[model samples]
Target chain A: MKLYSYWRSSCSWRVRIALNLKGLPYEYVPVHLVKDGGQQNSDAYRAINPMRTVPTLEVTEGGRVHRLAQSMAILEYLEERHPSPALLPAEPFLRARCRMLSEMVNSGIQPLQNLAVLQRIKAELKGDDKAWCAYWIDRGLAAFQEVALETGGTYCLGDTVSFADVFLVPQLYGARRFGVDLQPYPLLTRIEAACANLPAFQAAHADRQPDAVPA
Target chain B: MKLYSYWRSSCSWRVRIALNLKGLPYEYVPVHLVKDGGQQNSDAYRAINPMRTVPTLEVTEGGRVHRLAQSMAILEYLEERHPSPALLPAEPFLRARCRMLSEMVNSGIQPLQNLAVLQRIKAELKGDDKAWCAYWIDRGLAAFQEVALETGGTYCLGDTVSFADVFLVPQLYGARRFGVDLQPYPLLTRIEAACANLPAFQAAHADRQPDAVPA
Candidate 1:
């Protein structure tokens, strides 16, 4: 198995955490997203993943090169494929709650603040960088803060670190990186802190990655 | 079973389609998103769905009601809870493929152009309405077009309609509503045609709902 990833990508970090949690070993194949006009867009990489997104995992078994995209989907695949340590709850409604929280971050918060969307807001729409980003980041975070208050106990969903935590840790990492005042979101902050102590999350931190750049 | 839905909501449409596909009898409980500053924001509705999103299916089995949110999660629950007329394939990789395609629209396309996001972009951020809608819709459709071409034969995941088509139908409906051209995405259009032909999909059409607004 080989993962096509960029060390700093939140999506990649989500997958890394899942792999570590499941105790799966796979070769890390770094695809520098920003170097040389993004290796993701290259014809070579496009041939691998038509979507040209980071964290496309190739499973050699079943004689299939599965180009799995979407962080949440990939996490589900990993949890199902390697079911020793379940990342999601076994119950139905509990699973729904876990996925709901995960989607709140994955679908709700992440996409608007992504690199491509930010760039388009600047170059195509001619918006200011600092203000535009602050606008989107805060907008996404505000609603998330409200939702976080509901299911957030220790982790995003519950005391157990399910798929929601796997998704949340990365978004918080990105939110902090962008200078969003997370102090307003105490539940999210608390959730992040509890998640920070987990070894699975600690191992998947972007800074600890082999390809991470020194600050 | 009772579904809290707004006719025009893609999220609501997703569950509506799933209910039809699974042959589950459900009562439609409309929650108007636009009237009186959004009915979903009400305390009563919030009690129903903490996130306050549309398509909250209240499953009343043996006289107990359980509130479920998030279209994908709800769809998954329906698939698991009702084994007959399975929405997902038995095989893992194919299941992953169905999920990936579903997320491609759910996490990728749908969120960006959701009613709440668009309202924020236009009414809050003071964006040009036409440009704002065009930007997000076109970018998402373009990506979906590429993926649809690969994973599609007659339908999104081939002959049998999967959850991906359930997601894709609503998205294409929104794209067309925003006047985003579909000529560039023949595969998506083709898949949409197949979906439109299905009574499960046609019955779930926003216009066919009791609360539907006249076109």
Candidate 2:
């Protein structure tokens, strides 16, 4: 397996954590998002992922290589293909709650705060991009805190580190990067701290990635 | 099962289609997103869905009523509980492709063009929200067109209608609603036309809903 990833990408970070959690070894192919006008936009990379997004996982099965995109989908694929140390809850309702938390971040928060959207904020809207990112992040995290408080024990959906936790840690990194205050989200902060101590989360931290640049 | 929905919400439309495709009987409880500063923000609805989003599915299992928010999560739970007439492909790779397409719309396009985000764009950026919505819709649909072409036949995936089709139809409805030109996306339009012919898609369309207002 090989992953085309950008070190600082939140979506890329989510896939990395899932791979580490599942103990799946994959070669990392860095597709730098910042350097050279974003390598992901190149024709070669676009051939690999039509969306021109980072973290396309190339999985080889039955002598066929399948390249998959979208972080949540990739995570689900990982969970399905590698079931041990399951990233989703076995029960139906609990699974729904976990996925709901993941989608809250995936659909609600991340897209609004992504780099492409930020660039659009500046180029198209003539707006302050950081403020835009921070606004959505702050709103999303506050809402997430409520859900976390309701369902959480040690992670986002009880003691087990489900896909919700896998998804949250990266978004929290993104939140801090956008200068959103984490102080208001106590449950989220607590969960983030707990996840921070885990080796899988540690291994997938943006700053710890092979292609990470000095800040 | 009961679903809290808004007639024009694309996310709500997706859930409605999924329920129909799965042949599940669900009571439609309309939550008007545009009336009196949005009914979803009310304390009563917020008690049901903290995110205050449309298409919250309330399911009764083992005598416990579980209110599930997030359309994708709700769809997944429905698939899990009702395995026949599967919305996802049987193969893992095919499933990933279908899910990738779904997330591309869910996170990539839909969030950026949602009512709340458009309202923020208007209030915070003082930009034309319609244009902002159109820009993201055009970009995402263009990319989605490329993917659909790669993996499509009669539907977004193939002859069988999967969750990808379920997700795509509503987003296309949203794209047209936002005044996005669908001329460039022949595959998407073709698939949309195919999906439109299905009773499930027709049943779930915004205009056909109980709360639908005449154009």
Candidate 3:
């Protein structure tokens, strides 16, 4: 498998974590989000992902290649293909809880604070990008904390690590980038701390990725 | 089961369609998004859904009520409990295709054009909410059309009224509400028309809801 990834993309980061958890090795192909008017918008990359986004996984098996987009979908695909070390709980309600938490970040928070959104805010609306991002992050974090308090323990869905954790780790990184004060979210911060200890999570950190820029 | 729904919320509409498709009956509890300063944000409604969002499905089974927020999660919960008329295909790859199309709308389109997002754009940036919504909707629709061209037949994902259709119909409603010219995307409009003809989809239309006010 080959993953088209960017260093700081939360969506790409989520897919990387899932791949690590499933112990699936993949070639990381960097699609720089910043250089040359965004490489993702290039004709070649757009052909691969019409969404023109990061984290397009090209999976080759039995001499056929399946190019998948959308991080959550990719995570589910991985789980279906490799069921062991399951990223979701076996029970229905429990699995729903995990997906709810993941969507809270994926749809609720990430889209509102995506780089393209911020750039549009800055360019067209004359808005403070950081403040715009922080506001939504704060709202999403409050909701995440409420849900986490109910279902979380060492992870977003009790003792096991699930897709919720895959999403949470990167979102926390984004929240901080936008200067959201994490002090208000005890469960979220605690869960992030717990996830940080896992080797799978650690390996997928932004700084550890092949495309990471030198500080 | 009870669904906390508003007349025209895209997210709520998606859940309504899912419940209708599975032939599950539910009480409609109206949480008006525009009445009396948004009923969804009211303290009472917040207790049911901390996200303060519409279409929170309160499922009562075995004397316990499970209040599920996030439409996708609720759909999955319904699918798991009532598995006969499957919302997803049996093949993992086909299921992934369905999910990818669903997420393209769920995360890709809905969040970007949500009411709260438009309000934020208007208040903080003095931007035209309609234009802002239309722009994002256009971008998402273009991507949705590309994916649908590959997998769509009578419905998105090759004749199965899968989760892709569940998400696509409501999103098309939203797109039209924002004045998006759907003529550019033939496949999307065709799929929308096909899905609209289904009894399940018709029953879930925003205009058919109890809370809908006749213009």
List model 1 lDDT by residue over B159-185, tens digit each.
Answer: 888888888888888888888888888
TM-score of each: 0.93, 0.98, 0.98
On residues A1-215, what C-alpha lDDT tens digit does candidate 3 reach at each position? 99999999999999999999899999999999989999999999999999999989998778988889999888889988999899999988889889898999999999998878889899988999999999999999899889888988899899999999999989999998889999999898899999999999999999998889846
Pairs of residues clashing in candidate 1: none
Per-model i-RMS in Å? Answer: 2.1, 0.6, 0.9
lDDT of 1 by residue, A1-215 (tens): 78888888989999999999888988888898878888988999988877778889888776857777877778888887899799888888778777877777777677777777777667765666556556666666666666657667787666778888888788877877777788787887788888889888898899888888947
**B9-89 per-residue lDDT for model 2 (tens digits):** 999999999889889999999999989899999999999988989989988878988899999999899899898899999
Candidate 3 wrongly placed segments (more than 4 Å): none
Chain B alone, TM-score, model 1: 0.95
The C-alpha local distance difference test score for the whole of candidate 2 amounts to 0.90
**Deviating ranges (above 4 Å) for candidate 2:** none
The DockQ for candidate 2, computed on C-alphas, is 0.91
Note the DockQ of each predicted structure: 0.58, 0.91, 0.84
Q: What ranges in model 1 sit over 4 Å off?
A: A128-153, B61-64
Share of true Cα-Cα contacts across chains kept by each model: 0.59, 0.91, 0.81
List the candidate numbers ranked by DockQ, top first. 2, 3, 1
Pitting candidate 1 against candidate 3, the one with the higher DockQ is 3
Q: In candidate 2, what are the lDDT values of residues A29-68, reduced to their tens digit?
A: 9999978998999999999998999889998888998999
Let me know the TM-score candidate 3 reaches against the reference structure: 0.98
Model 1 chain A — which ten-residue stretch has the worst lDDT? A127-136
